[model samples]
Target: MILGRSAISMAIGIWSIVEQAVAQHASNNRAKGAPITKNVSMTRAVYTKLLREKVFPAIRKKWPGRKTTTIMVQQDNAGPHVQDDNADILEAGQEGGWDIQMVSQPPRSPDMNVLDLGFFLFVAVATIQDTFDTDGLIAAVKSSFAKVSYHTLEKCF
Candidate 1:
């Protein structure tokens, strides 16, 4: 889900994903550069489902008999968000007998995480180009996101 706020002079979009990508650039002195766009990879329910379906399956497929492998869960330092959703994933991993580790992100450090900056800039560029039509926006977003590999993202920022 996307939560947005647009008033006289500011626009902000926040996604359900615990991780956030933020980008800021200037078009003019007085005008806000651009509305910050947010991307959420997986929500709690979705993330849980992915753990049950995709992650577990991939792990089992790789090492069928062996029950242990190092698994890492990386997340930003948001207490409420982590408590609400991420904790469940951690608990489920333990119950499933998977050796899992949790990596808490440093607070207020979007730059430390590449995905945040990269993904946000990609979305912003796509949205700006796509302001005309809904379908066009989707296509643009998809194209931009697809191109957001390490090299492309670096060039964008």
Candidate 2:
């Protein structure tokens, strides 16, 4: 799931909420190798696609008349994330007439990330009354993400 909040306006932008199907484990009696339950990890390819196909477009739509030529996307220092100078990303940005740049946050700085600072807590509170299965959890998360107010987000900054 990808969620963005505007720096100035504190507007929320929910780009995508994709769920990965869990791999089923085989019967315990079987001695043969079986697929273990897997959670999809974000890779450079997935991140790049999220930026090019989802994030950028949502940003453009959010501020229709504003110049988006110098948009900067801030991300955590994850191993699978693409570097700022990645060729495909640069090309995509250029094609969209945007000067998109991926910037990594300072190491171990949870304070700098709004999601870490407050959003997750807010979501947790919101979801306290709900009970859900795996797929329902995804839906609940997405719903909670949408319901978060701009004022709440602004306070986190």
Candidate 3:
């Protein structure tokens, strides 16, 4: 998952054996100053690749001319994001064209990361309220997400 907080907006998705989670994040428009908009995906390698290659690139295109610095926060899962094959991503960033930072592992605390709580709230609020069919639930989740006004996000800080 791409856990970040900044002026620019971001997106994230998650696919677990039990369920799939997706979140679209934007910086709070009000006073606390603009924070990085983080796009995160909580999924295994296959899904994460789908999001990174297909989804992220498409979304990245919308923000033309914007420089994107990547920082990966990985949990102890066996996925491409955590595999050696993906080292090139960090290497590419270290090549000096873009800023890259990695969150430390081992003893890492998810609570310390704002995105952690953000993601939790996103999932909790999105899936709550009532039971529905697949499509209906999808609509409910989207509608719930839409209802998260700037005021709610600001309170997260």
Candidate 4:
């Protein structure tokens, strides 16, 4: 991988959107009468569901041009997102007759290192202070993401 500014500032398009789901079961504190739906962990099953039910559909609906274009979905080293999603994505892409592939992003890019992601860290910590519960946290994060514009992302690079 290149270690320069050019490597960090490539043409960017947001493909996968953030997904947050409520747990099927009640909170662990339910026995103490604090019952509430909790945010589910990012497990393989959950990621798979998001890819099949939400992401792919969204891509199909809003893709800029050519529905048959080869789409490369990039994800970080997150195990659930990269591990089996390759095979699963291949099969799903075939069923829909779309050329979709999941690619594991390199471990690091010079421009978007820890310093660039400081924007996210700041937003997360800033919003956490105003949130009181898991639901609030999720909402706050989603709101933060929604507010991010191309300008905001450009600053990161």
Best prediction by lDDT: 2
State residue 53's C-alpha deviation in candidate 3, in Å: 2.9
TM-score of 3: 0.48
Structural similarity to truth (TM-score) of each candidate? 0.45, 0.72, 0.48, 0.65
Count of backbone clashes, every candidate in sequence: 0, 0, 15, 0
Candidate 1 per-residue lDDT, tens place, 36-154, comes to 44544555565566555555455545545545655554556644334423566667656557654445667787554655665677779778772653445656766765665545534
Provide the overall lDDT of each model, using Cα atoms, as 2-decimal numbers: 0.49, 0.63, 0.46, 0.55
- For model 2, how does the per-residue alpha-carbon lDDT over 20-47 read when each residue is reduced to its tens digit? 4434544553333543323456777877
Residue lDDT tens for model 3, 1-157: 4334444334434322223333334434323433322334445565445544553444345434543545443433334334424564455434434434344444445545555466457757777866444544555655655665545555566
Clash pairs detected, candidate 2: none
Off by over 4 Å in 4: 1-35, 108-119, 125-129
Candidate 1 minimal-lDDT segment of 10 residues: 1-10
Cα-based lDDT at residue 129, candidate 1: 72
Candidate structures ordered by lDDT, highest first? 2, 4, 1, 3
